[model samples]
Target: MSTDTNTVTALPMRPVVADVLREAADADPRLVVLGADGQALAAGVRERYPERYIDVGIAEANLVGVASGLARAGRRVVVCAMAPFLVRRAAEQIRNDVANPGLDVTFVGVGGGLSYGTLGPTHHCPEDLGFFSALPHTRVYCPADVVDAAWAVRQALAVPGPAYVRLGARADRVVHAPDERFDAGTGLLMRPPGRALAVAAGAGVGIALDAADRLAGPGHTLGVLALTAVTPFPQERVRELAAGVDAVVVVEEHLASSGLGAATALALAGQWHGAFAAHSVHTGYPPIGDREELLAHYRITAGDVAASVLDAVRGPGAGARR
Candidate 1:
């Protein structure tokens, strides 16, 4: 099955933090943005409110510590950095300083998963979702588009406690219409109700949408569910969305062992008894390659997702061609 070109607008996911932060900072004087080797993440806001923005260099642990201190001083703090360093290097500080006391600090992690492309395994952050989900008083978000990215930032800043929002390196195809009503832990329906459901998060949502289109003409009605929130997993919403679907497939860019695939399976464990499949990145270090090449290599493309759904819903040989 060939992937169809998405006609929707592609929004720059990383720059969205600057736009949302600028707006949020204008209203709240207590807001501060911290960057750890991530100047691009604070583009717009840093220009307007230079005083409110601080570049902490490449020290990831120090970045979290400073943000936590600011939050303790009655200020809204947001730390922007690369996912791997932010989640891995600063794990101790994040757990002890930010998450432990339940401080209101929102961490924006760009170049999530394999988005760093040829940057290799050292930069890849497929384990971020698992780390954040396991932390107490921490929320996780993997926005698929600009709208969802903005909403995630706003929601993260508005709520209490620490939060993580993951973003890819390049632009993302718009998954939601402009100004679509979205809330945390709720799956957004991208297609009409169908017997087969395709649930995806982050970049996988766009691939899932294309897969749904590919399965349309062959008497296959596949419903697409786009989820931005991972931690605080929406068990009730998954149960509601999987109402009549005979089979469900989860697609994600992260590892199958710790990402959305695991979260969805844990949610639907005993509640729903039906065919289920998860298409995610394989365990171990990914081969060095560009983003598109890595995605195809891992078999997480539109064709791969469509084929898996077909096999789950219609048995083994149904998706042979795909």
Candidate 2:
């Protein structure tokens, strides 16, 4: 419910996940919440519905297998686990069990991208979007804040197929209003339309918004697009926005070749002649550091992203840098 775009609330989205799961469980008795060493995050659900909650320890593979089995048995299942382990550890189980049969399973992966910070690359999950989006009968969501996270949880539950919700560790940036209307497969424009657009997802949305704000001036208007939904890539909306923009920059906390930036580039392929730049993590297994340190290391900060956008907007014959 915060309107301040400059600051983020601590532990906002994490509690919202538990609340959403509790509410869904209240509405449907068939709803079951499973945790892969994530019981603490879903403690509320365990307390409220003991019969419907299961903690599978650190066995992420077994977590997916159990969830898939329950889903096949006509149960609404949600798997809450660390992002990297959930997406990478149980990838095969997810593909063969949940995605193949198209079961009702929602995987809530916390600490996506470099959210794990100093935890090392084994805990970082920058490849989840590519892995999940490539799966059939699967939908991927990368929410920006608590509002988007809540919506993703609800949407993943409402849908009757396998879904993945990659969330930040504790980022609660207020990118959207409390009552923001969200339509799946459609990116939300956080700023007014401009000559250039900064498309981003997850934690990068706030950075993109900041970059857009920093570039706002007499003739340097930049729009910020928040792509909460990854799979079912909002091709039409992206194309529509790209048609009016002179340049496009994709800022994300993922690998440049396999994240939102890659998706955006592909969506605009064979069309949209504007200059484009994808400002994302370009290296693998970055050095150990906190979230901010790591983002700075990868040059994914707001300042770096703003510079990239300006460079793209001011490409050859696009006028000198302001």
lDDT of each: 0.84, 0.84
CA deviation > 4 Å runs, candidate 2: 1-10, 317-322
Score every model by TM-score. Answer: 0.93, 0.94
Deviating ranges (above 4 Å) for candidate 1: 1-3, 6-8, 316-322
Mind sharing the TM-score for model 2?
Answer: 0.94
Q: List the residue pairs that clash in candidate 1.
A: none
Per-candidate clash tally: 0, 0
Against the true structure, what is every candidate's RMSD? Answer: 3.4, 2.5
Encode model 2's per-residue lDDT on 79-168: one tens digit a residue.
999889888889999999999889999988898888988888888888888888889999999898889899998998888899999888
lDDT digits (tens) for residues 1-322 of candidate 1? 2246635677788777788888989989988899986788788778998998999999999999999899999999989999989999999999999998999999999888888889888888888888888788999998988888988888888888899999887777777777788767576877764767888899888888888988886456788888888778888878788767777888888887888888788878887767788878887557889987888888888898888777777875443323
**Best of the candidates, TM-score:** 2
